[model samples]
Target: MQYFTICAMEDTDLSSDSDLDALINCTLLYAATKFKRKKRIWKSSYLRKRETHGEFRLTSEFSDDQFTNYFRMNRMQFEEVHNTIQNKIYHEGSRAHKEITTKEKLAVFLRYLASGNSYKSIGYSYRLGDRTVSKIVNEVSAAIWECLQQTFLPDPTEELWKQIAKEFEQRWQFPHCVGSIDGKHIVVKKPAKSGSSYFNYKHTCSIVLMATVDANYKFITVDIGSMGRFSDGNIFSSSILYKKIQNKTLKLPEPDMISGGEKELPYVFVGDEAFPLLENLMRPYPKRKVTANYENKVFNYRLSRARQTVECAFGILAGRFHVFRKPFEIKLASVDNVVKAACVLHNYLRMTSTATNVEDIADEELLSDQLTSIRYNNSRNSRNAFLVRENYTHYFNTTGAVQWQRDSILRGKY
Candidate 1:
């Protein structure tokens, strides 16, 4: 009985040791797992803290002048834009527990637009990732376009069109001229899988900006995002402006008497030879090898002088916003937004600033004087168009003639 009692005691001792060993192993495993989880949490928190604190903090330190210099806008302008886009860029911070402020986003985006810096470079300056910089830029650009379109680039009514025509006739000395139309190639990086669709005659990848400018160098109408491979005529025909004019939905003014009521003249937009000569559009006469002293030549010279407005508008846009001067590395949609935003901002700046000199920003040399032969469809309509041109030519030479026009033409100065 004593032996059996001892054996039972030994068995109880061994079972207790086995239970203790299993319990100790379980505790060690739990401790290791807890440590690993804490380490992970600590790492994430450190990274988040680092990301939240950086050069972006310095934005608050800039003075008004510094802000204007950096963002290319005065404080009032900045606030206006920021307030307009604040709701669009605001982040609720629900999932990530971290977010960028709306003001900071605008600042970052404006800096990118003003400087045309690479995403990585902008990220470095703003203490953001390149992806974040790119996202903010695109969002802010799109927001600017959406929020300011109606205010800056509203559709013109008949009175406004007539006013523009009057301005052209008074300032440019081109009677019945409504606006100047032109096209420019905005260079861009080749898009993926685009093949040669974006390749232009200049042997570069680009998108076309077809714009109509009033006498004051403001964009009256603009059509962007056309393939650069297309000619100006092709792009213009496909534009919304063309459709509106064709359908007579644009509310253009009625034909009025010209040259002291001798003949009726329709309000027209003057373009270079790359545009078609329509009932409401005029282009230069095709150059002939044997130059003649015909009225058509004088009319071409006058039309060319008026067409300078659109070219100057483009020059001012590119000069003020250097982004257009460089090849855009963004996607096509982003480029569209950027271009629209720039145009709106251009008009805004022109309307607000008193010291903006067009001569200072525009390169007069960039204006083209050479004319190309335009392809005319519909023979009867072509005859009518030529007749209209002839009437205008006669008026310019007679009743509408300026005192110095003949001298200027003789001096080869037109």
Candidate 2:
């Protein structure tokens, strides 16, 4: 070996400046090529091992309970969603390599939503890059919102509204009520260049989720991505739902006769004092200096009871998908998609889950009242709205009264 090396160096003419330079360049190029090959080998081996043993693999290995606990969904539900959005999420493999399966992408998205894990942490567990994880999560969440909106949260027809009103009456003992309306602050990271627009009274950066829920704790309609600094009344006034109601374009059912009286009333949504009282919307009487009469008290209690459904819906939403419990460290648009997806998933789960009692999942802490003061609208029909409220107050005290309503009012147990 020594003789061959000496002979090769003698033949290569190491004495010339140009030859030496060529030799050095060639040697450096050879070394770089060798290093790159070794790096490729190591990365391929690591990825193969990770694919074989990482948490993504465990998803298939897990038992039913483990699967449910990890993904916050059953196999059937996962398959249903996967099938609906398979075309959207599917990526055709190229000659370079096989694309990640749609199933894997969905699994990553669900795991992120269920665990609320950071992108880096989730990517590590799933053997993906953080950017890939983020891309998959956002894509899958947007697909969920688009694919499930019609089936899970379609606008209600007149008949459906009446059905909702009937459910409210039967389940909550509230007459002529269709749904409960409320708003929640979805905490988020401070947005770039957003000043105090997203800063809420709670001192946290957030977006508002204004939703109307039916008696079964299902979201009938939702208006999300409102500025957190806006009041609930302001948010509602700007919502599409409110606009439809205002223009009488929602095709609400005709007035129905009160159960025990000849007076007919339009179906109305029940809200708290943070909302303005309208002919089609009822809020509790102000709890300030004005003493609420017995009839007003009963009406308030009944409205509160009905309004509890929307609160409980939010509770169940946060409890099941705990991502809402923490501040989402993402862009504002991404947060909106995440929230919309969560809302649709909440409705889907509620429709399919076997748990009959809402108390099992409802987070009462989220339902606590946030009403600050009575918000009065400056509409021309303001006095007429008050008279409408008074009429309902009278009806609750007399014809539409319930046996236990009086006792509930007396005990101050709304």
Candidate 3:
């Protein structure tokens, strides 16, 4: 049998364990110590150093070059924002160290978010250590969240509620609707040795992000960090919405004609079956009739229209940042920060964008008409007749009361 030797072109006598160890050490040394030859000049310099020293010493020189190069690049970008971040970290608003600026650190963090890359990848791009990259990402994200919350989410005031109600009417054609409520599961890989707390009905570990969005797809309320094992209904029941409902402190806008001055009247919000049925909270009927009438159809239509904003809010966050589009692999504890940051950023962008009115999205009437047409068309075909028939029957049977309520409000009978 023939054996290969390190740097060997042919079989040799130097095939001992020490020889093999030396070869392995030399390979590691080369990878760690070699200068990243950016140009012919750099390559020549590195080659000259290698010739001057033995292989091991040459490797050490290259390692130092690599380390210094990485440190220098990282410091350049970090220095730009060092002071701003130091002030934030110190909370004294003092002049930051001239060495680095917070804006630079923030820019690096945003670059990570926009790219959805790993810390190591980000470090390589910024020429920093992975640990430093991780720290910057977390700190900058916290700062961004703080900045956004201060600017975007105000304390619940009557004026804010009134504005929200007006936006609802104008954007969704849903009168007196305070907000659209929904819950979404953000999938995550199951952690080792952890309990089954994160495992949901979807047979995967996840966390729930429940939100109340206004008609224009702006978040009015956000609750994160719910275990995925709980049902959406269960999560909602445990949320601040439930508390607000119980305490009756959520003093929303009174129902009033969109054409007239706000007459203090009762209005309702739309949710799905996951929420409890309440006079102030409207939900789609669990079932429909085969011969659904205009009222039943209208109830389902209006409910869907009001509920869509929450879906759209979730869609925008997930779509714009693909990081949450798939299962995450981090620790469960960090899920809340990710969700909160996403929500805060969503609101921040909405506030800054000129398209805040949501005129760019499809109108509710057009969407409703298309959906209804599809249902009617599908019901006529026997292939989908049973399901369609069930849907039709369910609406008339369960949604009649809601339709009447909406009509009564419209007619000033309530």
Candidate 4:
């Protein structure tokens, strides 16, 4: 009708039936094309009301235990983390479409992290666009790292290192032990055009997250985003942590004696069989197929105890932030930020939640830091490392020995 009205207003000649038919067909086609696309709308209404939903209710109406289950942290701890990153994540505007508040952004990001839900799924729950969900996660992750890294996961200081060593001695009974260092393969989808670099022995593509954690299950240092194909030992050896130790760049304290034991030893990080036994890094002695020596058994048992800190740390991370259980959506550049964010959050929770379960583990599987120095000569260092292990072994068996270590639990599985 409009096309005809325009023709009539211009007094255009349309006497021919064929021409009139052609004009009508063209107009109908144009109209169909114009209306075919869905109309754009503002304000996601009728999807879900986050205000009346868990985002608000979880804070006020729900119990702290329920809140912890959903966000992976109690309300108090969550509030502390939110407060630190709130300014950075705050969206300032007065657009017709409501802006996601800092709290909502954090809630969205934490929901994604705490549940490992797809962006679309989380978006549906929060009435957000999938892209918005992704953006919020990335943004919050960066903010968490930027705002909390120094206080929560800062580089080890001399005095802080001493304090950590003291805690280990008192808690885990490993004197001069500063932290436990270990690495786990974080599974990720194979990257584009890259062949075999990320492939690992388990027939999966992954990146390694290496961390050093103190006795109280707090991460002291972290190194992440290493290629997974490399063996754990090789990865550690080539790491900046290893390089610093080799070059003597870490401000490791001078050699000192244990409080209740003899033989002066340097501060060390305990690791599993994947790491070499260094003067400042202790590893268990190799298991024997035949009858094992009594001293080696006792030494391995004690080292295993110190090493459990890293194991439990990883377990708690996987248990709480379940994203670690499955293969991560393959993202290289942003993976470090995400992993680092999770680790920092772990520290935050450990620092704030006094009665929290530090021993939590992921069901069935998904198991998966501190420093040691180096010697220039491989042979000499090997000799020195053996002597150091022997020193700790003798110390544990005699003066430093605890009553519980005498139990039958000293038996090594391997």
Q: Judged by lDDT, which candidate is best?
A: 2
lDDT of 1 at 241: 87
Q: What TM-score would every model get versus the actual structure?
A: 0.82, 0.87, 0.62, 0.84
Q: Give me the candidate number with maximum TM-score.
A: 2
Clashes of 2: 0
Q: What CA RMSD would you report for each candidate?
A: 7.0, 3.8, 14.6, 5.3
List of clashing residue pairs for candidate 2: none
Kindly list the per-residue Cα lDDT of model 3 for residues 239-308, writing each as its tens digit: 8876786577887655454343223334566676666655556665445530345445455665676787
Evaluate model 3: give its TM-score.
0.62
Question: How far is 74's C-alpha from truth in model 1 (Å)?
Answer: 2.0
For residue 253, what is the lDDT in candidate 2? 88
lDDT (Cα, tens digit) per residue for candidate 4, span 98-195 = 66788888888787778887778887777677887788888999999999999999888899989998999888888888899888888887999879
In model 1, the runs with Cα more than 4 Å from the true position are: 1-32, 39-66, 94-98, 357-381
Against the correct fold, how does model 4 do in TM-score? 0.84
Q: Looking at model 4, report the run of 10 residues with the lowest lDDT sum.
A: 369-378
Instruction: Provide the clashing-pair count of each candidate structure.
Output: 0, 0, 22, 4
Q: TM-score for model 2?
A: 0.87
lDDT accuracy of residue 204 in candidate 4: 81
The candidates, ranked best first by TM-score, are 2, 4, 1, 3
